[model samples]
Target chain A: MGLIPRTIHDIDTPAAVVDLDLVRRNIQALQTYLDGTPVHIRPHVKTHKTPQIALMQIAAGAPGVTSAKVGEAEAMVAGGVHDVLIANQVVGPAKISRLCALAQNARITVAVDDARNVQDLSAAAVAAGVTIGVVVEIEVGMKRCGVAAGAPAVTLAQTVAAAPGLDLVGLMGYEGHTVAIEDHAERAAAARGALGRVIETKALCEAAGLNIREVTGGGTNTFDITSKIDGWTELQCGTYATMDAGFRPHSGHMFESAFWILASVISRPATDRVVLDAGRKAVSFEPGGTPIIEDPSGLEIESLSEEHAKVSLTSQNPDLQPGQKVRITPWHGCTTFNLHDTVYVVQDDEVVDVWSIAGRGKFT
Target chain B: MGLIPRTIHDIDTPAAVVDLDLVRRNIQALQTYLDGTPVHIRPHVKTHKTPQIALMQIAAGAPGVTSAKVGEAEAMVAGGVHDVLIANQVVGPAKISRLCALAQNARITVAVDDARNVQDLSAAAVAAGVTIGVVVEIEVGMKRCGVAAGAPAVTLAQTVAAAPGLDLVGLMGYEGHTVAIEDHAERAAAARGALGRVIETKALCEAAGLNIREVTGGGTNTFDITSKIDGWTELQCGTYATMDAGFRPHSGHMFESAFWILASVISRPATDRVVLDAGRKAVSFEPGGTPIIEDPSGLEIESLSEEHAKVSLTSQNPDLQPGQKVRITPWHGCTTFNLHDTVYVVQDDEVVDVWSIAGRGKFT
Candidate 1:
C-alpha cells in the first residue's frame, strides 16, 4: 500500500527487521570460528526461514544449509541451494513424497530414527526415481526424537543402506538437553558425553559395513564444543545467525542479536507501564524464552496479550509516549520469524530490502 | 500435494482441523441465549481470523465483527464484512492511514485510550476524506489499554467529539481481569463490578453532552454474565465459534472445542512417552495455554519443543505408533489459529472443505 520503505522509521510497527550488517557479521563470525577446524557450518534455515538469508550463509563458506521441515528444504532449493540436510524426521507419505520431489533437483538428506519411516522414504524415493539420502538420528538425551545411540542407530542406518533408492549418507545427534545449560563447564561436559556417543556409534556403524560420510550435529549453544569433537562433519547452529535474547547469554560472546521486532509504543497507561503494538503474535516466548527490549534498556516485557505487549520500566522511566518505536529482541528467532510474512532487511536504520519469510506457516 | 484429502486420515500431519457442525452449533447457541436480550453480538474475529468464519458469524446474527488490528479489518471487509470494530488502539500514522482507507469500504470503528491517538486518527481521516468512528475505551479492570472510568473517560469522549472528521461512536470496557475466575458466582460478581463501571462512565459521558451509543464489552468466558448487565449495546465474545481447551473449563456447557491440530505420532521413545509432529510452531502456549490430546483419551501433553509435542500416558498407553493421528485441542484458539495457513473444515471424519485463515500474519 505504500512505497518500498527506504528506512526502518518508514516501515510500519510490529514488523520483523533484520540488520543485514549484523547478519553478515554473524555469518562471518561462524565461518571464522570454524576456519581451520574440520567441522563445516550447516546453518539452520528455520531461524530466519528466508531462502535469501540461507543462500547468504551458503555463500559464506557453508557447504550446505540445514532445514527442519520438507517445505523449508523446498524453499531453500528454490532459492538456489543445491545441498540441504533436514535435521528433523520427515515422516508421513505427504512429506516423504515432497522430499523425493525435491531430491530430483537438489541433494536432499533427512534424519530418520525408525525403520518403518526409512522404508517409507525408500519406497517414495524409488517411486520418484530419485536416490534420497538418509541420516540415522541418534538419541542424544533430548528424548524428543531419534533412536538410541549404540545398536539401535546402527540397525536403522543398515536398514537405510539396504533399502532401494536410498543411500545411508551420515549420522546426526542433537544434544538439545545440553544446549541451554548456563554454566560453560557443565554444558561442555554434557555436550561431550552426548557427542561422544555419536562418535562411538559411527564407529559401530562402520564396523557393521555401513558407510557413514557426514556426521552432522551441534546447535548454537554447543557449536564450539561440537566443533572441537573429532567426528562432527557439519555443525548445525540455527540461532547463531539471527540471535535471540535466550541464546545471547550462551552465544553472545560469538554472535550478536540481529533479529528484532520493531514495535511502536501504542499506549503509556501508567508511568511504570507502557503497551506496545506487538505481543505474542509478533514475538514468541515458548521455545526460547522471554523477549527483551534491546533499544530502550529501561523497559522490560511484563506480559503479552493477543495483540498488546505490556511493558514495565525496570530502571528510570524513559519518557516514552504513544507512537515511539521500541526495538525488541525476540526470545526465539525461529518461532518469531514464523509469525511474520517478511523480514525488513535493515542496515544502520536504513531499510535496504525486504525478504519474504517463505517458510513460515509451512508446517504441512 | 496429494489429491484434495477426502478424509481426515488422508490429510497431512500437523494440520489445523475445525469441525463445522460444532461451529454452527456454537454460533446458534450464542444467538439463542441472547434472543430476548437487548445486546447484540459483535463477534471478535481474532479467534478464527478467517473472514469466512467472520461472515458466517454475521450470517448467524452478529451486527459486525470485532477486530484487534487494522489488517484484520481489511481481511474482514475483503471477505464481505460490511462493519468492523477494532477493539484496540490504532496509533502511529501508518495504521491510522490504513484505518482511514478501510473506513471508505466498511463501517470501521476503532478503540482509543489516548488523546494523541485520537488526533492522529482525526488528521488521517480528514486527509483521506473519511468519517472514522471513535470509541473511548475505558479501563474495566484489565490493566492493558484504556482510559480511566468516569471523568477521565468522559473527557476523552469529549475530545473525540471535538475532533474533525471523527464520530464519537461509543465506549468500550473489557473486563479481562475477571474472565478466567473458575467459579461462576465470583466471575459474575467481578463482571458486574466491571460492567457497572462502564455503565456509570456512559452516563457521565452523556451528561457531558456527548452522544454515546454502542457500548461494547464481554468475551467468551464472560458472555453469560455480561449479557445480564444492563446498558451494554454489544457483546464482543470471541472464541465461542471455535473454542479451545483453555475456555472449555468455563464455557463447556455452552460451546464445544471446534478447533484442533491433527498431528501424527512421530516417536515413541519410552513406554509412557509419545511425541507428535505438532509443536510450538503449530500450537501456541503463552497467550493461550498448553494443547491437550482430545481423541486419544489417555494421553496428556508433557512438553513442547519447536517441532514436537511430547505426550505422557496418564491412564494407560494407547499403543500409539508412528503415523497414527492424534487430535490436539489447543489451549487458546485465538493464538493457535494464528499458526496455520488453512483450516481443514471437517464433518463426520470427512474433509468437506478447506478455508484459509486469511487474517493470519496480518498483525500490522
Candidate 2:
C-alpha cells in the first residue's frame, strides 16, 4: 500500500508526488531480478531528473547513471555521481565545451552516431586534456537516431580509435519501438531482434580490433530480454523506477504507478461533470490521449485544457466534490518528469520528503 | 524583423526563444484594438508566465492580469505586480489561505461556479480579515468549470453577496469552443453568444439585488468579438502575447509567432528523415498535434518521442543537415510555456535579454 497522506492535506494541489513505498518496491523488484545476472544496471536519470533518485538506484547496485543531455550530466556530477553517460549525441561547441568541463572531474561517456559529432567531442576533449569514453550508437530499430548497425559501427569505432582523447568503450542502442507495445510476445520478439542488432554491431566493432567493454542498451520494457541475452553489458532502464500509464498490461513484468500528480477538485459545475485544478500543465498527457485519473468511481477524464482537467461523471460520483484530492497517473514518466521541479516523496496519505528535480529542463 | 542574433549561437540548442519584436507587436495589437473601447484588458499571465510580460502588458494599458492559479499570482506579485485576478476558482483551505495572504498585497479576484465553494471562500476571507473579489463563472459554450448562465449564476452571486468578507464582482464566462475554429464569422457569432450569456448573467445578478462591478471574461481568440459586444467590462486574453499553431488564420488582425523552441538537428539518419533535439518535451505538442517546424522545406513533423522530434521529408531537402538550429512553433502557448524555465528574449537573431519563467510549473 502507498503511504497514507495524513500530513499531505496542507500541500497545495497539482503537486507531483512519488510514493516512497512504491519506489522502493519498484527498485527492489529490478534489483531482485538482476541480482545474479551478468548484465549491470545504469539507471537513466531522465525519468526522475533528481540526483537523489539516481543515487538511490546507485546504492541499490546500479553501476552508474545515464543522462540524455550534457547539462544533465553536469547536474548529475554536481549531485555527486562521478560516473555518467550522456546517452544522446552531444553536438556543437556550446555543448561540447560543457562536456569537456564535465570530463575534467567525472568519468564522462557520450553516445555518438555521426562522425562529425565524434570529431567535435574529440576536439573538446583534447582542448580540456581529458580522455572521454565514446559509445558509438547504432541504428537498431528506432530509426530516429544512430548509424547503421554493422559496418557503420565499425567505421565509427575506428574513428573513435583514431581520435586523440577518445576511447571507444562500446556501443549503445535504444529499442524504443518495442518498449511500450501491448502484446507481450510481439514486444519480446522485437526486443530480441533489436538487441540482436546491437550485439551484431558489437561483434563487428570487436572484429575490427575495437575493445568493447560496456554495451549499454535496453530500457524498462526490454531489460529482461536483454538481461537474458548473452553479450549485452548493461541496461539503461529509466521507467521501472516509477511506472507510468504508457506501460501496457502484460505477463512479462509487474510495475505499478509509483508516481502521480496530486490534483484537487476545483469546480463542480454539473452533477455529471467536474473540473480539477490540474490539466495538461500538471499531468503528462502524452500522445496517448488523457492520463488515468485515480478512482473516483464512474468518473473519467474527458478532456484537458491548459490549466483545467474536465472530468465527466458518467455515473453517480456523489463523493466527487470541490477540495477533494485526487491522483493522476501519467501516460509517460520521462516527459511528465520534465514538467515538474519538485517531487513530494510520499507514503499512502502523508508526504515524507521532498526531492528537487535538479536536472529539469536541462535541454541545453 | 526579429532582433539580430549576435550572441544567440552560443546559447546551445533546444532552448525557448522569444522574438521580442513579435511579442511587442502582439501586445501592441491587443492594446491598440482594445484602446478606447468599452471593454477592459486584463492579460492572462498563463501564456508568458513572466511578470515582465505582465508588467509590459499593464504598462500598455491593461488594467490588471489574470492567473490560472494562486501560485502564478504569487509569482507575479513577487515580480512587483499588485493587481491580479486569478480567474479560476480558489477552493480548499490551503489555496484559499494562500489567496487570502496574497490579497494582503495584491488586489486579488477569483471565479466561482458553486455555492459551497463560495461559502468556503467567504469563511477563509473572513478568517483572514481580508475582502476577496468574487466573480460567478457562467458556463457559456465550453461545458467545463462554469455554472449555468442566468439564474444559477444569480444564485451563486447572491451567495457571494450574502457571505462575509466577499464582494461580488460581476461574472466570467469563456467561449473556448469557438476560439480555434477556422471560420471567422462562426467563431465571432459563437463568441457573441457566449459573451451574451455572461452579459445576461450580469443582468440576472443585478435584478436579483447583487451589485455587479466588473464583468471579466473572453480570451485571445474572442477578444475581438467581446470588444464589439456592449456589456463586456473586461477581457482576459492570454495567447495574444505569444501565439500558437492551433489558432486559425483570421483577417481581423495579424499576430506573429513570438515564442519558438530553438532546436538543433540532432540526427540526419536518412535523406528523407531528420531528428531534432527538441521533442514533445521541448515543444508543447498538445492534443491538437505536432507543432509547426519553421523554415524547413518539404519537411513535416512526423512524430515526437520524449527527447527527439522526427521530421519526415516528402521531397529532398538538400540544405537541412545535422547541427542546424530550427524553430518550432507550438500549438498551445500556455502549456508550452509551462514546460520551459527560461526564455531567451531575442529580437531577431541576437538575444536582447533572458527572462526566467517565474510561474513555470506553478500548478497550484
Candidate 3:
C-alpha cells in the first residue's frame, strides 16, 4: 500500500538481510582467487556467527574456521564446525579449560603472545587429556597483541614447544594499521611491507629449530594483498563474505556489498525529514562513518541515536513515507554482524532462509 | 594458579556488571526528588533492561516503564510491569498488531507523531478488542520524532481522540538537544523553555476538544530540571539508574555510576602499552568518547577496536599486567547497555547475582 516489501511484508523491521546470491558470489570469488595458491582460506566466523554459513564456507573450500574468543569457538563447534582456530590470544585458566574441553570434540588451535598464557593453555589441555595446536603471534604493525618480531617471537615459539599438550604449529601476524588504507597502491605496498616483517619472523621461528606447519594472518581488508604474498599458509578473512561500506573507498578486489539492514520508516515528521527505526543498536556506526542508504542521494542522514536514525529528504523524485522499507549498507561488517541475533537470507524479494547469530555476544 | 579465577574469575573477559546497591540508591534518590514534585516518576527501562532492576524502580515509586521499542515493552510486561508506555512512535501494521496484542495483556500506551499511524494503531486495536492509550509526541528542541509544536500536535491528538479503540492519554516531548548542557542554570532554563512549548501544545490540544491526562518529558540529563518545570505530570528519566561518564562533565544530578564493564587484560605487549579484551563490542564508543578507566591515572585508553582496547599505562606505581581485572565507566549508558546479553550484579568484589539483558537489542 505504501511501497512496503512485497515478499518480506510480514517480517519485523530493523532486520539484517543477507543476499544469498551475493554471499555465494563473494565466497566463490575468493575461492576462485585462492584456487591455485598454496595458502588455504580459513574464514573468520566473527563476521557471520552462523555455523550454517561456516558450513557453507567449509563446503566451498575452507579447511577450518577462525574464532576471536573461546565462547565463539564453542558456539562454532556447537553449530557443527569441528576444526576451529582461535586467532586471538587465550588467557587465564577458565577460558583455557573451556578451550581444552572444546578440543575433546574438535581439533582446537590458539594463538599465544605471552609465555605464561602458553603454559596455562598447555596445562589445561594436559589436564583435559587433549592436545592443542599453538601459534606464536608476531607483531607486524598492529600493536594490540602478539610478541615483537625476531627474538621475542622466537622465544614465544620455544615456550610453546616446551609446554606439554601444546604443539608449536606456526606464527600469526596481523597488519591492521595498513589494511584500511584508501589508496590501492599504498595499501598494497604497506601490506607487503608489514607482511615482510611477518615472513622474517617465520624465518626466525624456522631457525629456532621449530617445525612450523602453518602460518595464518590477514583480514578482509588485506585479503587480496596477502593472497599474492607467499609464506602465509592460511589467510583469515571474515568481512569478505559480507563487504561493508568502509571497504568501498579502498577495495582492491571489489567485493560486492552482500549484507544490508532492512528497516521501515516509522516516523515522518516533516516533508523534508523522516526517521528510520535502525540506529546504533540495530545498525553499527563504526569504521568512521554512517551507512549509505540504498539510494545514496535519496535521504540525507541527520543524526543517529541509540535506536533511531534521522534523515532529511534531499530530493522529491521518490518521496519517502512512513512504512516504506529501505536497505542500508553497514559501515563495518564485523561491528554490524555483532549487533544482530538473526539474519534473514534473502533471494530476490523473498526470504529464503533464516540463520541464528550463533556467536553473537559470545564475547568470552 | 596461573591467573585463573576460581569462581567468576573464569567468567570470560569484558563483561557488564551492575552494582545493585547503586541501582537502589539512584532509584531512591530520583524518587525522593520526585516526592516533592507534582509529577510522577516513570523510570525508562532502556537503561537497564533487566526486569529485576525495573521491578526495583517500581518498588521505589515508578508507576510504569518507558520503552523505546515494542520488544522492550513486551519484555517489561513479561517481567510483571503491567503499565507500559512506549515513548517513541509505533508505526506499521505488523508492529501495530504486536502493540495491540500487548495491549490486551497489559495497559499499553504509545506516542504518535503521524495521523496515519494513529489510524493504523486504532484500527489494529479495535480489531483486537483492546483499547490503546495514545500520546501525541510534541516536537521539543531535539527533533527526532513527534509533530511540530502547537497545531501539528493538536491535529494528531484530534486524530487519536476521533479514532475508535483509542484514548488521547497525554503528550510526550523529549528535550534531547538541551538535556546535555554543561551548566546547571543553562540546562534548567533550556529544559523549562522546552517543557513550556510542550505545555502550550497540551493547551492547544485541550482547546481542540481533546483531553490531556498526562504530560511526560525529561531524560536523566535533565531530570532535575524538568521535575521543577510546571505542567509536566510525569518525567521519564532513563539513565539515572546507571549513570555514565557523559553526565560526569556536566551532571545536574550527579547519579553514581552503577554500571561498569569488568574486563581482563589479555595482553601486555609493551611496558607502556597493555590491551584489555573490551572494545566497541563490549564497551560502546558512543557520545563521542572512550570509557573512563575506574582509576583515571592508572591506564590511559589509546583506542578501542572491534574486540580489543589498547591502553597505555600512565603510572608505574600500580603496575598493570595481563589477566588483571579492571572496571570501566562507559561514556554512554543506554548505548553500552544494548551491547551485552548479561549483566553481572556485583556488591563488593564478588558477584551476588546475574541479570539477563532481556531488552538488549530489542529494536522493533
Which residue pairs collide, candidate 3? none
Q: What TM-score goes with each of the models?
A: 0.98, 0.96, 0.96
Model 3: per-residue Cα lDDT over B85-198, one tens digit each: 999888787778889889989999999998888878888888999999988888887768888998777877888889999988999998889977777888888888887989
lDDT of 1: 0.88
Model 1, residue pairs in steric clash: none
Which regions of candidate 3 deviate over 4 angstroms?
A1-6, A295-297, B1-11, B295-297, B314-317
For all candidates in order, the CA lDDT equals: 0.88, 0.82, 0.84
The i-RMS of every model, in angstroms, reads 1.8, 1.3, 1.3
Q: Pick the candidate with the highest lDDT.
A: 1
User: Residue B218: error of model 2 in Å?
Assistant: 1.1
Models ranked on TM-score: 1, 3, 2
Minimal lDDT window, size 10, model 2 chain A = A1-10
DockQ of 2: 0.76
> Candidate 3: global Cα-lDDT?
0.84
DockQ values, each candidate: 0.69, 0.76, 0.75
> How well does candidate 3 score on lDDT at residue B241?
86
